[model samples]
Target: QPALCPKGHYCPNGTRFATQFGCPEGTLSNGVGLQDASECELCPLGHYCTGVGIHGAPRGPCSAGYYCLRGATTRTPNDNVTGGICPAGHYCPAGTSEPIDCPNGTFSAATGATDVAACQACVAGRACPTTGRTAPGAPCSAGFYSPLGSA
Candidate 1:
């Protein structure tokens, strides 16, 4: 006899009811009828599996512009617990494990940016602002001119 295995549980070929193995805190099971413990899959970056013996279909995807680290199984929306924001000075697309720094002449002023559009270009006449997360830095002081992206 076979039963439905939840996302956080591992059901072997002959697993009994409720006796299934736990997928641990950082892993999960996406489907049912798992024949081996190997079926337990790692929760990819930007994704989570909070409950036990659950399915990935309902609780997956760590939200756009946010990266979910490996072995992570919980929703951490800007809370910095289960997950974290994209952060300033960088752009983070959906389902990313890390953020990419804004290239020279470009800057990002907000967190959780889903695309490069979040990065703004520095004015050619103004000195690049030393500030992070904010693009288009303040204009150079009187008489102090600067080329594009000048720091």
Candidate 2:
């Protein structure tokens, strides 16, 4: 008696055929019939898929220090990971995985920096006056007024 083909395998007019069957869409055949279709798997945390088909081959993993920017499928050979770069004036301590902001008194003139130099002591006549203040506009402390007033 003729029977319906399996979900993934091929059937001719209600006749189930085991061999020469095509794999279901979005899946790849690793052998024959429904049992031959290989389930698609997600790329590893540090890796991404660039193309289709899974025949015992693993997708490439992102390089050390680099992170995946967007969600990608398929297996490809060009995927890579990049290290975190800090901005100017900012310091990303060694072994630190994420970017950190420069201290309160420090400033970053650029992006992806790693280290921040102590803010230049407020100019000779000018003083920071406060702990979190930087830049040349900071006012002088009490009893230590700037001779130039608002220079």
Candidate 3:
């Protein structure tokens, strides 16, 4: 006979409190006949959850190009994709899911740069050349003299 499995818990077989266990800290699920904790999926990045999930449904995902933390829910939900932005003078290449800084010779003033190509080279005359890491802030700020590799 089928056991009386409760919501927010899983019943692999004929069992009760002796076998049922709460969902792990990073996962959630619902329904009956659940076999293992693996049925509870980890909350995706850029999202959060407050209480245990009613069903095996994701709370949400962060917007494109923006990063969101884990386990976000109604109280801690994201209003926009402004969780964080790839700072200027850095790049977030499409190849990887993480953000990276631009090389010394190159710099970028744009936000959410999703590729190394967004990094702009410090120009001559208008701006000093960049060396590495320390990219020019607005083309050397006029008076600050910079050689070919100013970054």
Q: RMSD (Cα, Å) of candidate 2?
A: 11.3
TM-score of each: 0.60, 0.28, 0.42
RMSD values, in order shown = 5.2, 11.3, 7.6
Give model 3's TM-score versus the native structure.
0.42
Q: Which residue segments of model 1 deviate by more than 4 Å?
A: 1-21, 29-41, 54-59, 79-82, 126-151
Q: Model 3: C-alpha RMSD to truth? A: 7.6
lDDT by residue for model 1 over 59-150, one digit each (tens)? Answer: 66666677677655655555565567788887777666777777666777788887787778777776554544466666677877878666
**Model 3 over residues 1-151: C-alpha lDDT tens digits?**
4555554555555456623565554455655656666676555565444455345655555433444444434323234432355556655432222356677766676776666677776655444344324345464555666555345
Write model 2 residue lDDT over 101-134, tens digit each, in one string. 4444333355433344533334555643433232
Total clashing residue pairs per candidate? 11, 18, 12
Model 3 / residue 137 / CA error / Å: 6.2
Off by over 4 Å in 2: 1-85, 93-97, 116-137, 141-151
**Global lDDT of model 1:** 0.67
Better of 1 and 3 by TM-score: 1
Q: CA lDDT of each candidate?
A: 0.67, 0.38, 0.51
